[model samples]
Target chain A: MLFDFAKSPIVSERQYDVCILGAGAAGIALALRLGRAGKRVALCEGGGLDYEDESQEIYAGHTFGDPYFDLDIARLRYFGGSTNHWGGYCRSFEPVDFNRGYLGDDFRWPITHDDILPYLPEACDIVEISSDYQDRLVDEELGLRQVDFKYSPPVRFGEKFQDEIERSKNIELFLNCNFTDLIGADRRVRSVKFRNYADQELELRASAVVFAMGGIDNSRQLLWMERRHGARFFDRDLPIGRYWMEHPHFTIGEALIKSWDQANLYFALTEKMQKSLGILGCGVVVEEQGDSTTKRLIKDLLCVAPGIGAWAADLAGKKLICSYRFHAAWEQAPNRENRVALSDRAVDRFGVPQSELHWRKARIDRETMLASTQQFNAFMLRENLGRLQLRDWVYQGDEYPDDDVLAGYHHMGGTRMSSTPRYGVVDGNCKVFGAENLYVAGSSLYTTAGYNNPTLAIVQFALRLADHLGKVV
Target chain B: MNRRFFSIAGFLALSLGHVPLFRRYFPQRIKNGWLLKDEDV
Candidate 1:
C-alpha cells in the first residue's frame, strides 16, 4: 500500500519540511527517520523500485578482492538505486580517515567520527543491520570487547524496507522521478525538479534539500546543474569531480596446501578488522604503515572451513555451503588528478551535460597495495594458517596492473567534505559552503578514508541530519 | 554508409523501443531512442 508512482508520469511536487533526492541508502533512511518524527518529507528519485529499469545493461567487472565477474553499473537506476546490486558489505570508517587536513587533496569533514557516533544504531535499523547506536567497537575506546560480531545479510533495500516505506505517513516517495536541479532563491534551495521516462517534469518546493544519489549520479547531477546554472562551485577550483577515490579490489593470490583441511574463516575477528575486512559493506580495520595507515576490504570471497571450496562439490551428505566474506580493501590516497568532470561536450536526455569520469589510480595508491600484499603474505606465513595466493592480474603495474582489467566500483570522494570552502565543496555536516539548506549525503562527502565502504557512515550521517533538522524545524 | 555516425553499448540496446545513439563525432540528441527488437526476440 505504498504511494506507488509506477505508471504515472507526473507526480505531485509541493512544498515540504524536508526534500531528499535519491532514494538510495541515504535518502530512504533519512526519509524514514524524519517521517517518524512527524515531519512531511518528499523523497524524490530518478529510478523506480528494485533495480527495475528496462533500459538497463549488464557487463563484467571486479568486486572487492576478486577476479572480474559479470556485473552491470547500468542495471542500477531506480527507486532503490545501487543498494539492490550491493553485495551487503558494510563497514564503518576508521579514525585516521577523518583527517584534520587530508594527506593530499581536500580537507576533512566539518564533523568527526564522534559527532555521528550516537546515531549508528538508528542508522543500522534503517539498513536492517543489527547494530548498537554507537558501533565504536575498536580503537581502544572503552577497552571492553570491541566489535566481536559482523552483520550483512545480503540485504536488498527494495524488499527489506518496502513495507516500512509504504506505511510511513510522514514520507511520500515519488519513484520514477529524476532530480534535475535545485532552484535557488537567495542562499537557499527553493525547489527541486524531476521527471519520469514519460518525459514529464515535476518540481518540489522545500525549505532544505539533501542530495542522496549514489557516488556516480550524485556528482553527475551536481556537475550538470553547475554547468547549466553556473553555480559558485564551478569557478573556485573546488574539487567537485576531482580527487575521485575508491578501494581497488581483486584477489591477488590464493593460499592452498598439500594437507589443507576444512577450516576457513567466515567473518574477520575484530570490529576494526570487520569494518576494514570489506564484508557486509561494513567496518574497516586500521593498519599503520611506515608513516601512514592501510586497510584491505574486498567483498564476496566465500571462505569455507578451509578445504571448503576444494571439496564443495565432492561432499554429498552436507551441501558444502561455503559462507562468503569480503577479503580486504587496501587504503587509497587522494590524487587531484584521478577525478570525474563534466566533459565540455557530452549531454544527457534533459539537456543536462553528461559526466566524463576520468578515474585512475596514483603512484602512492600502488605503493600501498604492494606494501599490504607483502604484509598480508607475511602474516599468513607467520601464522601458518593457510596457503596464501595473490591474483596475478593485480600485481602487474604498481597498483593498476591492467587498468582495463581491474575494478573501481567503490567510488568515493568527489564533492569532498572539508573544513574550508577553499579545500572542498561541502563541510562536515555535508552542507555546501556559501549556500544554506543544501546538504550532500553519500561517499562523495569523504575526505580520504583509505578504501573504506561509505554506506554505513553515510547512513549514520543521514540520521544525524534528521536529528539536527528536528531541533531547527 | 555511416560507420562514423554511431556506436552501441549494452545498457541501451536491451530496452525495447529504444534506439541507442553512438555518435562518431557529435551527439545529435539527448533523447536516446529505444531498440525495436522484440520482433527479433
Candidate 2:
C-alpha cells in the first residue's frame, strides 16, 4: 500500500516487524526481501515517486575541505535515490579488498567477500545485470589480459519495484514522508517521528530499524540525532560522518595504439596481471584523435615506441589516428578526516541541520594513481602495445588535480562496519554497535571503496543484511 | 636440425619485427617538465 502522507490521514501510532528508512536501492531491496519472508514492513521514503525541487533542496549543504559537487545536486532526493541517474556499471569488490592486512590500520571489514558472495546472484537479478563479472579477458594480439564489467539496464528502484511493492500484502510504502527524529530508549530505538509535506506529523514503532539513506543522509541523519539526542544515540566515541570517501575519477594519461587489434588491450587488464601488479582495475576508452590531437599523439608516441609512431605517421586513410583515455575509478584511502559533519549555521526546509562535507584525497590516493599508471605503462611497454603520454599531474609533484575533475558521486564509508565499537559504527551484521535493533544499509557500511561502482555491491550488501535480519527479526 | 633452425629464425624475425629493438634504448620518455607538443618536439 502506497500512502502519499501529504494527503493521506496520519496513522498516529503504527507498528511493524521491520521499518526501513530511505526508499533507495538498499531500502527497497530490503523491503522486498523482508516482505517475501512474510514479515510486515513499513518502508518510508522521504519524497514521492518523482523528483521535486523543494524536496531536493533538503540535500543542499556546504563543502568545507576538498572541492566537490554541490551536495544539493550530487544525490537525487526522491524515490529510487541516486539510482535515478545511475550509469549501472556493475562489478564486485576484489577479493583482496576484504583482507584487513591489505589496507592495514584496521581499515578492513569484519566480514569477508564470502559473507556477501552468497547474495550476489539475487543482487544481480535485482539490478537487471546478467552474466558474472568477467575478471579476465585475453587480448592475445597484444599479449595482455584485462578485466571486464557488465552493464545494468540501470534499474531505477522506484519504477522497477514500485508496482511489486504496492502489490505486496506485507509491505507498506510511506511516500512524501520525512523522517524527523528517531526516538530511542535505553539503547533500542523506541519509535521514529516523521512528517508529511503538508506538515502532518506521525510516528511509528518497529521491532528492527534499518537506515538505508545512502552515504550522505545516513551519516547526516545520525550525526544530527547524536547531537540532539546525545552521543549515545549512535556511537558514544567511535566516529560517525567521518571517513567519507569517493572514487576520484580523473584522466591519468592518453595513449595511441598501432591498430584496432592493438587497441583492445588498453580497454581492460587480466585478473592475473592485476593481482601481480597490485593495482586496481580500470578501463581505457579509445577516442578518435582530432587533427591537432593526432599530431600530438604521434609526437608523444615517437619518443616511446618509435616504430609504431612511424607507422601511425605514415599509415594511409585507414583512420589509425587515435588517442585513448584511461578512466580509473580507484579506491580512496579511508582517512578519518575525509568526513561529513552537521553544518552549525544552516538548516534545510524541514528545519533540520544540513550537512557539510570535509573531503580531500590523501597520500595513499596519490600513490595508488601513480603506481597504477606505472603498472599500465609497464604492461604496454612489455607487450609492445602502443604507448601512453602520461598526464601532466601524474609526473608533477604529489598534489592531486581537483580543479577540472569531480568525485565519482559514489558517497561511501561513514557508518563503517567492524567487529567492535572502537573502530566502526556498525557491527559485522550491519547493526549499530550500541543499539540492538538499529542497522545501517547501503554504501555507508562499506569499509572501503573499490574501483567498481557501488550499485552492484550496494545491492549485494543489502541482501546480505536482509538475510541476516530475516533470521532474528 | 634444419626444421629446428628455421623455427628459431622465424621466432627471432617475428620478435624483431613486432617488438622493435630501439624501444629498449630510447623508449618514450615521460619527460619531467611540461608536455612536449609536436611543434615543441
Best by DockQ: 2
Number of the top-ranking candidate, with lDDT as the measure: 2
Q: How high a TM-score does candidate 2 get?
A: 0.86
Q: After superposition, how far is residue A92 of candidate 1 from its true place, in Å?
A: 1.1
What's the lDDT for residue A71 in model 1? 32
Q: Candidate 1: where is the Cα deviation over 4 Å?
A: A1-6, A9-13, A50-75, A99-107, A132-149, A232-237, A256-328, A380-405, B1-41
Q: For residue A255, what is the lDDT in candidate 1?
A: 39
Q: iRMS values in order, in angstroms?
A: 20.5, 10.2
lDDT of 2 by residue, A1-473 (tens): 88888677678466788899999999999999999999989999998889998788889899987678999889987889899998888877867677634446557789888998888889899988774765454554332446666788888888999999999999999988899988877778878889877788888899898999888989998887887777545567668888888988877667665555434333444445445544444444344445676677777656655665676676524665466656555778778888889898999877788988999877566655555555556665565555666666666453557775566889999999888776678999999877878899999898878777888889888888888888988
Q: What is the TM-score of chain B in candidate 2?
A: 0.46
Say which docking band candidate 2 falls in.
Answer: incorrect
Chain A vs. true chain A, TM-score per model, equals 0.75, 0.92
What is the C-alpha local distance difference test score of each model? 0.56, 0.76
